[model samples]
Structures are given as C-alpha cells and as structure tokens.
Target: MPEVKNEHIKAILAIVPEKPGCYQYFDEKGTIIYVGKAKNLKRRVHSYFNKEQDSNKTKVLVKQIRDIKYIVVDTEEDALLLENNLIKQYRPRYNVLLKDDKTYPCIVIKNEYFPRVFQTRNIIKDGSKYYGPFSSVFMAKTMLQMLRELFPLRTCKLPLTPESIANGNYKVCLEYHIKRCLGPCQGLQTREDYDKNIRIIKEILKGNIAQVSNYLYEEMQQLASNLKFEEAQKIKEKYDIIENYRGKSTIVNHSLTNIDVFSFDETDSSAYINYLHVNNGSIVQGYTFEYKKRLDEAKEELLGLAITEMRTRFNSLAREVIVPFLPDVDMSSTVTFTIPLKGDKRKLLDLSKQNVKQYKLDQLKQAEKLNPEQRTTRVLTTMQHDLQLHALPVHIECFDNSNIQGTNPVASCVVFKMAKPSKKDYRHFHIKTVVGPDDFASMNEVVYRRYRRLLDEEEPLPQLIVIDGGKGQLNAAVDALRSLDLIGKIAIIGIAKRLEELYYPDDPIPLVLDKNSETLKVIQRLRDEAHRFGITFHRSLRSKKQVLSELDSIKGIGEKTKVALLSHFKSVKRIREADQEEIWKVVGVAKGNLVIAGLKQASDKIKESKEK
Candidate 1:
C-alpha cells in the first residue's frame, strides 16, 4: 500500500463498508466529480489511493478528491442498477457521456376510455404505454400506417367517455364517412369491438402477429359456418394482411423469443453498442449508440454500462441476453447471459455485429468529411502502429527500378507527405553506376545517391523509405542506407509484388497486412506511382538513344551538322530520303556533302550485309 497523504481520505477509508454499492467522489467544493460501482466498496475505493495511478487522468482525479459518499446495496446487480441511476441523476464530469441524446419517436397507446394509438416524442406518466423510443420516425410511422389500414381505429382526438357517448355529445367525422374509422366518437361502434381492435394493435406492436393471425382465422371460419360469407371474407382480408407483414418481418426461427442481443465495437476514444430486441423471431427494435470514453475503460465495462442503459430505457423484459462476450455486470438469477456459438441466436448476434461495425464506419466517415485532416492523421497513425515505427511517417519516399532487355535502366523516387503525393518532390534517377538490367545494383546506386546528396545539402530526410521489391532488392537498399550511416535514422520497408508482403530490414519473415487496410493501400499506391514514373522515364531514354545511335558513328559529319539535318527531317530515314540540296539548305554545303556521303556508305553496308 502507498502512503496516504490526505487525512480526510484516510479516515473515510477506515470506516467504509465492504458491501456492494456505488461510491461518489467529491472535490473540495462539495460537487461530485466522479461516480463508480463495486461489489466490495472498501477495496474498490481504497484502490484509488493505495497505488500509483498509471493514467495521468486517474492521478489528477485522485488529487482533487476531498470527500467520499456511498449507497449500500444487497448484491452486485443492485449495485449496477443504483450506480446507473446515480450517474444519470448527477452526470459527473469524469463519467463516460452517453452521446445519444436524440428523442426518437415512439408509438404511444394513450390512457383513456377509448385509447388512441399515435406516434409521439413526449412521454407522460399517466398509465400510458410507450412501445418504441424507436431509432427512426419512419419505422414508427410505418407501423402506424399498417395498423390504420388493418383496423378502422379513430384518428381524431375525442373525449369518448361513457358519459359523453351516452349523452350524444359528438358526431361522426369525415374519417367515419370514408370508412377509415368505426365512429366510436358518435357511439355508433360498441366499446367491446373498439377495445378488441386496440388489444390486437397491442399484440402486433409487441411482435406477436402470428397469434393475431390465428385468432382472425378462427373468427373467419366461425362467421362462414353461420352463412355470413361477406363478413368472413373481410376477416380473411385482415388475416392476409397480417400474414404478409409477418412474412416480411420475420428474421429467424420463431422459438427465439423475448431475447436481447448486444454487439460491441470501439476505437481509442469512443465505443459503439448495437442493440437488437427480438420477439417471436422478429426484430422489434434495433439501435446503435455511442459512448465518449472518459478513462481507459475496458470493453467489458463499457458493454455492461450500455446493456444496463438500453434495457432500462426500452423497458426490456427479456430473460435471455445475447452478447459477444460476458460483460462486467452481474445479472443475478433473473436474466441469463448467452454467448451463442451457432443456430438462430448466433445469427442474431452476427446481425448485431454487422450493424455495430457499419455504425462505427459511418461515424468515422462523417467525422472525416467534416475535418479532412482527421482522416490523414488516422491513416498515418494506423501506419505507424502497423509498421512499428517510433514516430509518425509524415514524409515518405518510395523507390522502384525499371528496365527492359538490359536497355536504359532507371530508378524513380516518389514522395508522399502526410499520406498525400507531393508531386514537386517526385524525382527520377538514371542508373549511373550499375550496368545492364541489374535491379539490385540499380536500387543500391539510386538509394545511396538519393540520400547521400540530401545529407550533403543538409536537407530534411524522410521518416520512411519504401522499396518496391522482395528481400534481395531490399537488402541492396539497406546496404546503401548503412553506407550513409542512416540505418537507424529512417524507417525502411520493401513490398513484394507477388504477395503484397512487406519486409523490414534484417528480418527474413515478412509482415502481411490485410488487403483492405488503408496502410496497405497507401503503400501500394506509392509502389505503383514509382513504377509508373520509372517506366515512363526509361522509355523516353530508350527513344532518344535509338535516334542518336546511328548519328554518333559518322565523324566527318560533326554533332552540329547531324543535329541540323535531323532537326529538319525528324528522323534518320527521312534525312536519307531527302535530296542533297534540301540537306544543304538545313546545313552548310560542306557538311551536306559529307552527310550525304556518310548516309550512302551506311546504306550500302546494310545492303551488303542483307545480301550476304
């Protein structure tokens, strides 16, 4: 145990109970700054002061604590529940903030004599039942639309008490005339029939459409037995509508009922939880919410917090909760936590995982769209982590060697700053030291030349260097960096074309990154850009060499005379076909005579070789 410097905290620790409950930490100003829960309150609270806190934030939190308060509970489950309530009551600055604050629409069954079903955002405590707190208004409205089509319920707000209806206080409205309502307001529809439809509406909202279908089927059969074919057909239509809707909404086997599924995803600063409520094998509710992490909370703790919040918010009474892993909360004997491995429950878990992943991706995309630099920083950070670099590779350079048939060997260096191409810094190199199509030697020469000049000129060196080759070429480049005493100064990697494998210096085994990862994509782009640049420069050199080769053999016709003739004619063959007078016009008479004679002799030599 560490030394306790604060007498107030030491006194509190001496008498604190070891029971299950929530504890509140208060600053000198008597305001609660943090709230936490634990099974053994004494040990958990003492842990803050007994050790050197690893996180700077935790250290700061401990330094400001002036008082301690707690509420005792019977079990860990009660502790979790009480902690959630207190956190909500007093949103302490150090607790993770639930980022979802939007009030989603819900289908409300208002409390009245003739209860009305409608979509609302406000909740009243007057015995009214709210079904959803749905994630989308469109989903709630779609349910309302289907209910209105299936049953002729009243849409108008009327005081349909027994006294008002008995006194004939209201009249039929346009909805009643159009057959969209049964005119309950005018006392034309019996209370039993109206309430019966409302009961069925509740069943549908609870995701029990099959039970309603069975009831309607039996009613239709009974009506037909009494020789009422028209009424029977109407009931059959209602049954068909429900059956169709159920067919469209059912997601899994019907036996998996009254279950809650939660999948977790997260990043460094935020966590996402996707919740799904399944009833009668159909999803009744699906939502994904985010939490802004205030401390280094584990996935288990954050997931437990989310599960508690979601179940309480939606009033879920599910006995079975499907999770990807066991959360850090005790559910007691009331609820069973299931980590499904296969079957229908597993499908529900997978669906939740998919939703959570997509939600995280959508959030990242939205944040990046708002601030483009965030995306760049995220990509570079990912690269640094994946490549095990000591610092962020803000400036990166990639090199590639290009050649064909041992002709015009060249290398290219493409620069990337902050994960974007810096075209002005792009450079091409001629293979000066290496002869023929020796890629390894060409890489060594260019890599040495590129950095040696940078060191000589005192220019900035790149944080990373990427070579486009396997181990052999990578070793050559590493030797060059070693020669310049730059092995430890800059990070270097080589990419193999066959497998897209990345290799670090002095390591034989390659690092294989995911094909879809952004780090791999950026490295691939740099390699491809260097290859394209080198190939273009190599081709240009080849074309120029072919044109200047034949002219170099003619000595009497000097360089100036050859340039003048070729500049006018555009090619050696064109100059050969031109008359001596045309050549004389481009050059002087002496040079023209000498150039015509040299061309004639070269043409005769080609003819003699072909004849032989």
Candidate 2:
C-alpha cells in the first residue's frame, strides 16, 4: 500500500498470523497509540492500510503507525478479553477510554476466628469473603446494619481466638452489654453458632433472603410449640424482619435468577452502557459507565467491548445474559445470549435501558455545569446535525407576523446568538406594503426589508433563519432570500404551530425532532418569542389608533390637547367616567367642556348601537 511507508510495519504485517488476536500500533517514540482486536490478525491489520479510510480519525491513526505487534489467541472471545486487558494496562490514545475512576465500597467478612463484617474499599487477597463492590457506601452500610440487627455479630476488634477466650484474656465491651453482640470474644457465644449466622449472612448478601426467612419461620414455630412464649416472640420478630427485607429485595419472579442485563445508549463521540446483576429476582448489583470513543466504532463493537469489560470487572458467571440486541462477540458454547421480549426479563432490560439514559443525561449535565460554553457548543452541534447544516448556527433569527383581523398589522424578528435570545438585536416591523391579514405577504416584506438593510450596511448575515409558519410563510421567506441571492447562503426552516413540524425549502416531508431535543426546544423558543413580540407591538398600535380616532376627531382637540387629556386621566374610559367638574379642573373649562361634550356624544352613540 502507498500509505504503508514504514518498512518495519510492512515486515510485521507480512508474517502476522491469520488466527484471532489483538494488534497494537506504535508511533515514532515507540509508544502504543492504538490497540484493536481482530478475528484474523493478518486480514484486520492489512485492512487498515488496504483501503482509503472514510473516517478522518481512522485516517490519522493509520498515518501514525511506525511499529506493529500482534498476539494470537485461539478464539474471538479470548481476543476481545485480551484486548480489553491490554487497553487498560497501556491506556492507548486511540483506544476507547473507560471513564470510571472512583472505587466503590464493598462489605467484607474478614478472615478471622470469628470473621468481622465491615465496609472497605480495598480488596485484599487473604481469603476473606467480599459481598459487593456496592454502588455507594451508604448501600453497603445499610446492608451491614441489617445483618448486625438480624444476628448479634461482634462489633469489636478484640482477637477472638480459642486460646484467648479459654484463658479469659478478652473482656466483653459495651456492645455485649447492649445485646448488640453475642460476646464471642469472652466465649459467651460459641464459634459454631457464629459461623452458622455467617453462612446465613452470606446467603442474604447473595440476595437469597427468602431461604433465611423460611429457616427463621420454622425456628420460630418450634419455639412457640415448646411453650417458650418470650423466646418465640423474639424469633417471630426476627422472622418478620427477614420477610420484610426479602419483600424489598424481590424485583421480579423468583425464577429469574443468575441473570445479567445490559442496555446501551450513545452520542456522536461516546457510548454509555448499563449493567444489572440480578440474583434470585433481585438486582444485587448495578453500574453504568461511559466509553469515550477514539475511532468510528460500530455499536455492536462497542457493546462487545463494554460487555467484556464489565463481566471481567464484576466477575460475573451467569450463563444467561439479557441484552437489547445481540452483540458481535463469539462466546463459548456454555454461555447463552438472550434478547428478551415482553416478560420479566424484558422489564429488567427496560430498567437497564432507563438507567443508561439517565446516566448519560446526568453526565452531560455535570460536564455542562462545569463548563457553560460546553452546553452552547453541544446545542449548536445538535442543531447542525439535525438540520443537516454545513456549519454551526451561532447566530439565528426568527420571523413572525401578528394582526387582529388585518388591523394594526405588524411583524417581529427575534435574534438568537449562541442559542440564547439577543433582545437588543430584535426588530419590529409595521406592515407597510401589506394592508390585510396576509401572513405570507407580511413575512416576505419583513424578511426582505430586514436582510436588505443588513446587506446595505455590510453586516454579517445569520447562519439560520426561522419562519414561524408552515409551507406558505416559509416559501415567502425563501423568495425574499432568493431576491438577495441569499437562498443558499443561509439555512432556513419553518415551524408549523399545530404539531411543531419543521419544513424546509425543497423537502415536502418535514423533519420532526424528538420532543426533548435541544434543537427543537431552541426553535420553539424562537418561534414563541417572535410571536409574543409581534403581538405586543400589534396591541400597542391598536390601542394608540383607538385613542387617536376618538379624541383627534373633535373640533378643538389637537395634539397638545390630546396629550393633556391622556396625561391627566391615563385612559379614555376613566375620562368618560369623570364628570364635567373633574374635566374642567384638568384642561380648563372651555376645552374641557368641549372634551366632555365630545366624549359624552361618543358614549351615547355606543349605547344607541348596543340598543339596536
């Protein structure tokens, strides 16, 4: 290949195996920049240089390869697992980066004579049993509290060896006095009983609470049959507690056990995956994580990577896994992949999907919170993609027309810069050329006048223009842009009021975005703002016209006289309510008498019309 200039890379490619394996690419400094898994090492490695890469990222990655290395495996699953390990170990620049960094807490039963149960973040390989890497420490602590309440396990750090207890070297602390512990250190509780309780605790941590509840119920019944009323009452209370905890843990049918559910959500540059570990119908563990993509990885590929990563991280051993879709991974015959439809399994899958979506949203909100400019860039990027625009719409303008039965017709133009309303740049237009309630004509006139003025003044044109009506008004605005040869210069869209459908110039079918999409929200805001501004201007003009016609038609009442009357009374209705004595005090009796006589004549005409 012409692009494969490195002699060393060509040499490694010549002898690479045809078996399933992973490959790593290195730059001039001999640092690995990319790692990839392939079913056939030779074919996948050669495929990179064999064709003209479509993705700019892939093309750049291919150009930086100076050395190549491959490790062959027996199966595609093994290759994927190995690739995941190598990526974590090296964290290559061109590999999908796992974004999780915090270590969650786990409840551990420490390896001791009488094992101590507590919450810890560190996992030691000293034969101690660890229940969970719980989502939060609060959850771990809650489980610990429940266990301590159910069984009086020791809460002290004193050594509980048989020798120490036999010699009476340890003393029972306040925990034993309060009956919170069985005083195992002082030999008051035998090791056998404590170990029995530990076994039941393990079962509970595994989400097998029903088993423990059944055992407790039988014991409580035995105690009551023996006529031991007080002891039986205590056992009954423990049984009830176990039953309540079990009810809270059961999320689905008990038959749904040892299952792993996965769901996927993604954006342009990243993929998010949620995992739910269900045991005996209960969600024992759940996690959602993000993968920052390096290349244009397919959904199936990313899903495969995520499944491998999580399964290894959690050490999941379930034979059956529920997923939204079958990932492109080759597993052994022992494991089964299920795409569930309309059942408890489907409910778990839905829950997983919901979690992934919420996680994606929260991650975005947090990032935008830290960097306000990021939200603007993201919104404009979404707009650019949805509208199929060639560039970001940093500056946008929307037009709307308002008229009450063709009276006081006016139009408004609202400006949005960086996806926010630019109030100072907003403009209002009175319908000069159009004399009726013709929205199409008014839109055309306003658009032409607005842009023509901007063109004359050598101002920068907006990247997008939104017309607040469907096909007709949109076409009118398009014609205005065409007159100035700006049709292809700016992206324009029309939004219909009925369904919020978006219309383009040539495309008859409108593009409807998701209801929650930022692009749709911004467009809706612009349309609503333009409509509000136009309506406000229209109302003011109508009110002004009504005042002029009523007061200016009088014989002696001129501009100054009209201002004096309005300034004193604030409104015509109030002036009409005032008596002649009140009017005389404001505008002098001579003009005031004429004003009172004129207003009284107008009010009498209105009353006569209503009577007819």
Candidate 3:
C-alpha cells in the first residue's frame, strides 16, 4: 500500500475511476479505515485527497488514507444499493449506520403432517409457514399463548406414528394438563377435530378473527341443536376466548382500515421515528427509529423517506398512510396520505404520536440519568475523536468463550444496544467441529456462525465487535470475518482482561483506559455479559449430559424410558431422591427396579469417589 498524502494526491487522482461505485480508504498497513459509495467514484475518491478544501472530518479521514480501493457498478442506484449492503457488511467507519441490528422473532408453522408452531428469527424456505416479523419475543410468545388457548393444537415434539399413537407411547405434555394442547400425542382426538382447530388458527393468524368467530358461533348452535351438549360447551368456550380478544381489539379503530401511522421526534441531535403498522383495521406491529443526526429537512420529508424505506424492505404495505404531517412525495392512486382530525383515524394517529412523545421524554430522562462527567460517555467521545468514527458507539457486541479442560467448549456473543442490554439478541454456540480449548479456534467458530447468518440474510451487521481477549482473539475474529468476505466491514476491538487494555487492528500497541474510566466500565459490562451468557449456556449443557449419562447405565432403560423419567423429574438428582412408589409412578414397577439399581450404583460410586 502506498501512502497518499499531499504529495500523493495527484498520483491518487490519476488512478481514480469516473464511474459509480463504492470505495475503501486504507491506512499504511492496508487496514480499511472507512468505506463509502458515490455517484462519481472519481470525484468521491479525489475529494479525500484534496488538501486545500478540508474540514476537521475530512482532514481526519485524509490523514488515515494510505491506499484506496474501488469496485465499479453499472449505475448510481446500483452503487447506492451496493453501498448499503457493504456498509452493513463491513460497517465501515464513515457510513451512516443504523443502530438497530437485532433480529425480530416470528411465529412459524413447519410444513408437516402435524405442523408445530415455534418461534424463530431467521426466515428460511424449509417448507414452513411464517406469520410475522414481530418486534419482540414476548409479543410473539403472547400471541402463541392466545392461539393455544383458543385452539386445540398439537404441541408435542414426538414423531407421530400409528403404533406410537395407538399404544400410548407418546405421553401428553404439560401443555395438555394446562388445557393449552388437545393431546393429539395420545390419539384422544380424531384427525378431523385437529384439522378443524388448525383451520381456526390459520384464520386468526391471517387477521380473519371476525369470520372465524361467526363460523364458531354457528357451529356451536348446530352442536346444541343436535343435543351434543359437551361439544357445544367446548365450542362455547372457544367463542368466549375470541370475544375476550375482541374487547382488546377495540383499541384499534376499524373505521380507518389499512392505514400506517408515523411519528417523529428528536433529542440531543438524535432523531427517532415510530411506525405503527395497521392491517385489516388493526395495529399489528410498531417500530421505533434511532438515528445519530437530526433531520435537517422538514418532517414530511423524513416521514416520506421512512415510508419508502419501509415499503422497500418489508412486505407489508397499507392502502393508506396516516402521518402526523403530510409526506413530501406524491401518493399513488391506490394509497392515500392523510392527517386525520375528528375521527377514528385521528385517534390512531394520536396514539402513534403519543408513543413518540413518550419516547422523546424518556430520552431526556436517560440523558439526565447519566452523570455530567460520566466516564463511558467521555471515553466513547474521546474514541470518536481518536478514531474519527462517524457516530457514537450505540450498539456494541462482545464475544467470549468458556470450556472445561478442552471439554464442553462453548462460545457466546452478547449485544448491548443504546447503552442497554438486549438479552434477546444473545447467541450461544457449542463449538461444533472444533476440538480443545484453543481460544483462537473457539473464537473463530463463534464469529463465523454469527456473521455468516448476517451475510446470508443481507442484514446490517453490528457496529462493533469486541473480543474478550487480546490481539490473538482479535486476529481470530478478523480472520473469521475475512473468510465470510466481511473483513473491513465492521469495527473490531479486543479488551484484554489482564491489563484492561483495548487493541485495534494495525495499532502497534494496545490502548489502556483509565482504571475508573467510564468507557472502560462500559467495555467491562459488555465483556461480563459475554462471560455470563457463555457460563449459563455451559451449565445447561452439563446438567443435560449428567442426567442423560446416569439414565444410560440403568438396565431395561431404553431411550423412551429414560426420556419418560427425565421428562417427569427434570434431573437425575431429583429422580434418585424419589422413592420406589414415585419412580413406579413415572414409568412402572418393572422399569422402577432398573431406576432403583441405577440410583444405588450412582450413589455408591459418589461415596466411594469421595472416600478416595
């Protein structure tokens, strides 16, 4: 790499392309410092080396540029699109990054004879039906709970076989005890009954609750007329669940059907936009925006940009968009843009605006909560100056590994968004295809898994990846990213515990924060979170293994019998403490004898081992 200073500006300009594309700015050691897209690559690339016209930002960027790299695209629009992709992939320093990177959970129905409802963040075409891109796991779980209560669906994971169903090999799960499942595992309900309930679940998921309720009412009446009183009562119970949900649905105004409501606010130069997604006359999803720079244009322009971006990214589109202010763009004939006053639309719009207002107030409260001389904020501010970051470090992810003497090795990646912990985005890996406690290999496994998903989904990558060790771990992460073709797209730093040091790629020496520095504290928090997540995951894996190992040695205890016992007692320790009667209750006296022998052997071994 050739250094590009005032003298090399002319030489750099000579090789610049006059086409639309993205460019990379690198330092002397060929480490990328920033990445950006441009309408005219030549002009954009040349601007960096222009000595006469330099602001503080430009000067800092120029000082770091020893080499430049460019990728040519056919059109400026393509360049813009590619730029967003690369910025999201590399998370280069100069790009305007979106702080929100957490994957939203969704309800999925696997395409199977007995379709199971489960939660997932990634949407794959593995023959399954997906219902949402819900913003929160809690919301998705709540919806699933409501569905389970209203419908007699199968929640068992056991494979459905004619023999297993008839012989009662599959035991009803706790969900049946709680009346949330129909216990199809026991073959108590006919296939027709299960299919009928599935139809109702599909209707509810498709926003056809009204139609399903009407159909259920007629069915209930028919059952009563036929003198099937028990069946009628069951139908009546389902109707009550529907009716309860209906009362909550009243909060959504049906008068303004198929509308989107948006609200925008700003605090401390940061702007936020909240979007309320209305479909079939109900608000199904709400999103909040957090951006570094405040909008210089009118509110309408910001709203238009948001709407256009949302439509481009998400599959949901509304017939009308209700905004706090009018949008700057021309509305399509099928779409109406309105500012409602005196109707249900007004109420809906007001509801979105109130959320924005509350969020702005909350931001103020958060700002006030921090000490005026807060160390973390000060360190981040200093880092921004030192490294010339385009924005503050709002979303940071830290990686760490945990293992026991090269066994049960695992790694964890934990995220912190907006200076607050995002527990839902935490990920754990079992160090598959890796052996020993080699920190580098373990870190590599975790990094590859984390970013490979991001690249595949074309989702925005994290703003920063902090390793919990020194340069070795940092280099391992960098190598993993490069393998995924994502190197130079994200900021990488390592926090070494031995000296509380921070190491950046290409920096000859590690940067040590003050012992009590606020920034150092924040890094510590992130490192601690990763450690905690890894340890928790390791403990769960160990407990599961311990129980399985104990059960494996028991005579006449096949996989099914072991599963039955563990499912009933949850742990080997609990099963051992259970008397013969309790053990018989779990499987039967015939199997209980094997469990008793297993317990005695395990206990005797423990005593002998302790004596040794």
Per-residue lDDT tens digits for candidate 3, residues 373-442, read 3434655676565444566776788999999888799999998876668999988888887867798988
In order, the Cα lDDT scores of the candidates are: 0.84, 0.82, 0.72
Each model's TM-score?
0.54, 0.51, 0.37
Q: In model 3, where do residues sit more than 4 Å from their true spots?
A: 1-383, 553-579, 597-612
User: Candidate 2 vs candidate 3: which has greater lDDT?
Assistant: 2
**For model 2, how does the per-residue alpha-carbon lDDT over 236-281 read when each residue is reduced to its tens digit?**
8877777777322214333576898889999888999998777644
- Pairs that collide in candidate 2 are none
Cα error, candidate 3, residue 582 (Å):
3.3
| RMSD to truth, every model | 17.2, 17.4, 30.1
lDDT of 1: 0.84
> Which of the numbered candidates is closest to the native, going by highest TM-score?
1
Write the candidate numbers in order of decreasing TM-score: 1, 2, 3
Comparing 1 with 2 on lDDT, the higher-scoring candidate is 1
Model 3, CA-based lDDT? 0.72
